[model samples]
Target: MNNLIDELTPEEIAAGDVAITSELVPWHFPMMNDNVRNDAYEKALKAALKNGGTVLDIGSGSGLLSMMAARHGASHITTCDFVEMVAEKAKIITARNGFADKIQVINKLSTTLVPGTDFPERADILVTEIFDNGLLGEHALVAIEHARKHLLKPNAQLIPCGARVYAMCIESSEIYKNHRVETISGFDLSAFNQFSSYEYSGYHIEKSEHKALSKIASIFEFDFLKDTKDESVEITFEVTESGLCHAVVYWYELQLDKDTIISTAPYLPQLSCWKQAVQLLPKPMNLTKGETLKLVAHHDNEAIWFNRL
Candidate 1:
């Protein structure tokens, strides 16, 4: 047997070729290990495939979702991933799992796929899990929009029909330190703060020492079945506790189906593979209880950000 890892030079390994087989690996295992996420998706797939129909899976990492659809009696499944390595691996995985004949793996982006060329015809169901920590960071909106127009049949069922995003102000020195640098070892290292990420950063809110300064409020909602565009929305939140507001923490409720929902909210009893997103403020604001704070949330179909108003 040929060993693939042995073919790579030491330089290639150091260059992240072997260390990171695919950018998908970081989250792939976590997602596969998440019983809550897996169960919810399995349940949704069963419900959608109860009647047996052709399914199109976008961003089908490891072909897990596609296999799930197959297990639930999908007549056939066409799954695609942008990463060539991921697609190749999925093909082998599906074949080994006895789904080689039921599922077809394509190495291309869903947006680039042609209906007849990619598959025999438009699929009757669309299932995908292309969300990032902040929901839109994986270009999910763009992919779903394109797939709905060119790949899926009219009124095709979406695994996750819609999603609602929620946000809340928080006071957390631990989370703030990850983004802002002030002084270290009596030296002013604040100059490096310019490199801090303006976009939302991922963090496990339940694991971090933090306090909720304001009530969590729904800020945005997206329907995967409909066309969407870049949007900006301003939301006002009333402070419930007096403290230094260092960041705005956000999570999403993923509506896998009418009855299946999974959330990344910190209060949830189980920890999900997806972490809550934290948008650090330029500077911490001393908030007073009963005061209202306004912030604008913007999404450009890919990235999301927040700005104080």
Candidate 2:
């Protein structure tokens, strides 16, 4: 009998002539390539563990963060992932990293964890990379709230202590193609484009592809240590340049601690795996300087969506 995990369909090879297999794990590529993100977390953990404190790592993909906590001499480290497949791999990876005894890997969601049953005590510090490009796209609000209620101490510190989401109105024909349906073969298929869908357009885009038509607007922010969060909100931005507004470009600033930070803004020296998310409007609208761009941003079921009003 063939198992699904063992199945691989012949497909075109990407980079280095390596065909992405069914066994291709999504976590590994980013974990290895995202040195900036990892370095930020590692620096903060090193400082936070200086005096030696207990740590709890949520969404502990491959147990890297938990291992980082362990490597830095945290008094104790506990990690958990929502999937059993990831948890099992993390368990083995943690051991191979010589952190088996220092860290504990649980194959369950952080929300399902109870202090008395899952650990001897609440965590003195909570660390997680539970964010997507749009910031709240991964249900960080719900998970962190639940963890605050049951998993963390009253005064626990948080790595990536805070985060902010910024939005900018843009004129990008290249981006509009991603979501809008145009005429196909000289036939009006526009009606068949009956619906629109949300998407994540990671920032492999060039600066020439899109022009910013507005000053950056701060749409959302999260202080992991203190905020419970509001998922639905409307924000307004004033156009700084006269242009056709085709999309909203959003990025994040992650405060790993007081001093370390990372951003996915396209203008930055390098882009992160969690690239800027593009929210394509239903159609292009001609916008002018000082014009209004009202946006409603919200999240449901761990997915974030943006719309213009």
Q: For residues 123-181, write the lDDT of model 2, one tens digit per residue.
A: 98889988876677778878887888789888788877787778888898877776677
Clashing residue pairs, backbone N/CA/C < 3 A, model 2: none
Q: List residue ranges in candidate 1 displaced over 4 A.
A: 1-24
Candidate 1, residue 113: CA error in Å? Answer: 0.6
- C-alpha RMSD in Å of predicted model 2 compared with the true structure: 5.7
Q: What is the TM-score of each predicted model, taking all chains together? A: 0.92, 0.86
Best by TM-score: 1
